[model samples]
Target: MLLNCDLGESFGAWKMGLDEQVMPHIDLANVACGFHAGDPDVLAHTLSLVKQHQVTLGAHPSYPDKQGFGRRSMQMSEQSLTNTLHYQIAALEGMANVQQLSVSYVKPHGALYNDMMNNPQLLKWVLQAVARYSRSLKVMILATAEQDKHRELAHKIGIDLMFEAFADRLYTDEGLLTPRSQPNSVHNKQALLQQVSQFHDDNSVTTNTGKRLPLVADTLCVHGDNEASIMLIQDIKQLLNT
Candidate 1:
């Protein structure tokens, strides 16, 4: 499976993630928009690094919650949410255009991503924004028990969909991501490897409840913000290679 990671989170003065060390290992780069943790300079630098490594570029739009690092969900009107999504993608497009690069896919970040999976109304708004921006933008979505629900909706909207499986997070028996605030939200190296190992053999994940949940993965995600992310990615590459 192709590997992906969130990058471009380092804002001015404050720093986060092992982007430089991890970029070479990832196949997709989800660059953060300014509303979250990236500035124009950081975005430019991140896009450049990902391009240098020949990784596919993807835009990561989030709820306008930089202070909460986009992890906090917001209740917004349909119009406002649609506009916010369009705004973030356009911002990344503007920077990418300058570098002779173009984003090929879209992935919501933090609460926005979680909301898309849980709230169908919010997902429709997000998809509307993506289609309005460009029908060609493929959308990245989490692969869960409700995978067919997304496929049906995305098919109806005529937007291409890519399913992603998490490499470092715990899953619930229902195939939903366990809340990050809960314990064992992020897996240790051995746990992470054990989870991904199933992806190759059966396209499945071992849930926190010890159930095997089937999933289809177009790409595998590793969180760059974790202290163990670099090492985790290294093992992921090694495992995939084997």
Candidate 2:
């Protein structure tokens, strides 16, 4: 399976993630647009890294919430949501164009992603935005129990879908990610590697309640917000390679 990470989250002097260090280890870089964390320079530098590492780029868009880090849900009218998505995707595509690179997909960030998964109308808007932007760009989403349902919707919207499983996040018995607000929502180093192994070896993951849930995923996602997570990312890469 291909590995992906949320990179380019660092904003101005307030840095976040070791993007320069972790870029080489990932297959896809979900580089954040300004709304969540990244600034113009950060986006440009990240695109350069993607080119340097020969990694695919994907636009990581979110609600216009730098304060909550795009983790807090926000309500928006359909037109406004559409405009918001288009604005973010266009920003990344424009910068990528300068480097002779292109974004292959769009992954809604944090609350926008979780909200889209749980709300059909919101997802339709998201798909429509991506479809309008460029049908060539796929929408990356969580791999859950309702794969067929998601696929059917995306098909109707005339956009492709890429389902990704989190390597460092806890899963529920239903195959959805454990809410981050919960205790132990994220895995430790050993647990993270074990989860990646399970995804590689079994096409499944052990949920928070210790139940094995089958997952058909197109890609695996790992975090790299700190030095420790960066080491865990290297271990995950090695584990997946094995």
Candidate 3:
């Protein structure tokens, strides 16, 4: 029942969410490395805030496309993709070491994440990189009954896996997240709160298609880019605690 947010997304002159405001309510902070939307200074600052708030730190690695903010997939060879992932993880690990903190997990960002779930070859590469670089760190995969193969592969490889459900996103009947292009991919606070209540009560999620799907997950994701996300997170935490 941990709540996780993507932080340290501000790169260079561009600023992102209010990490400090959101950190207090969250249990985990997925800090972005340079591959997607962060810099070394941002990483250092974010790590300090996470340490102060006692939130578990996770690495948010993405494809090396910063322009699209790693939301767009790149057509790279398997070796190239693996190499980039290793590089990003290592960079974050080094930053964490500087602050005497260790990364607790890894969650691929944006397109890389979606691709890994649907493409076995890419998934294998990501899993291999995690094993080779940060073997002890858990990989957070999107929760879905249809993607059990990815979970099985992780277990077979001896890598710890964590299933994550999106608190602000809609799901399909098959238990996959609704595509961002869809009209109601993201939810408002009221809808999100209602969904959270249902999930807390029964571990079930109602998809956009009006089908109920049983879901069991260790963590829930709240996107940093959403404007009202911090308020939503605070409310959800209160609801869960009560």
Candidate 4:
């Protein structure tokens, strides 16, 4: 499976993920588009890095909540959300054009992601925004048992979907990711690798209740927020390679 990470999240004096270290290891980068955490310089640098590593580029748009890092959901009308998405995606597309790098997909970051998956109207709004922006660009979203339903919706909207599974987060029995606020929602390094291993070996993940859930996905999502996470990503890369 292709490995993807959320990158280009640093803003001004504050830095986020170790993009320099992680860029080489990942195959696809969901770059922040100045809404949640990235600035114009960050997007340019990240596009350069992705080009350097020959990695695919994706726009990681979020609600305009940098303080919460886009983890807090906000109430937004369909028109407003679509307008915001167009603004962010177009901004990144414009910047990437200068580097001759094309953003191949759209991946909503943080709460926008979670919220869209649970709300059908919101998901349609996101798909419509992407369709309006570019029919060639696919929408990356969580992989679940009901993915066929989502695929149908996207097909009706004249766009495609790329389902992704998380490598370091726990899953629920309902095929959703466990909420981050819950205890043990995030896995340790050993457990994280084991989860990825299970995904690679069986096309399944053991849920929090110890039930195996089938998760067919095109790509796997991994993090590079720290030294340990970077090591985990490298190990995951090696594992997938083998």
TM-score of every model versus the real structure: 0.95, 0.96, 0.95, 0.97
Location of the lowest summed lDDT over 10 successive residues in candidate 1: 223-232
Q: Judging by TM-score against the true structure, name the best candidate.
A: 4
Lowest summed lDDT across 10 adjacent residues in model 4 is found at 128-137
In candidate 3, stretches whose alpha carbon ends up further than 4 angstroms from where it belongs are 225-227
Clash pairs for candidate 1: none
lDDT of 3 by residue, 8-60 (tens): 99987889998888888889899898987999788899999998998999999
| Sort order, TM-score high to low | 4, 2, 1, 3
- Evaluated with lDDT, which candidate comes out highest? 4
In angstroms, how far off is 77's CA in candidate 1? 1.3
Q: lDDT score of model 1?
A: 0.88
Candidate 2 global Cα RMSD: 1.3
Clashes of each: 0, 0, 0, 0
Instruction: Estimate the TM-score for candidate 3.
Output: 0.95
Error of 1 at 141 (Å): 1.0
Better of 2 and 4 by TM-score: 4
* Alpha-carbon runs more than 4 Å astray in model 4: none
Q: lDDT for model 3, please.
A: 0.86
CA displacement after TM-score superposition, residue 96 of candidate 3 (Å): 0.9
User: Over the stretch 83-133, how does candidate 2's per-residue lDDT look in tens digits?
Assistant: 998999889999999999998999999999999888889988999888988
State the number of backbone clashes in model 1. 0
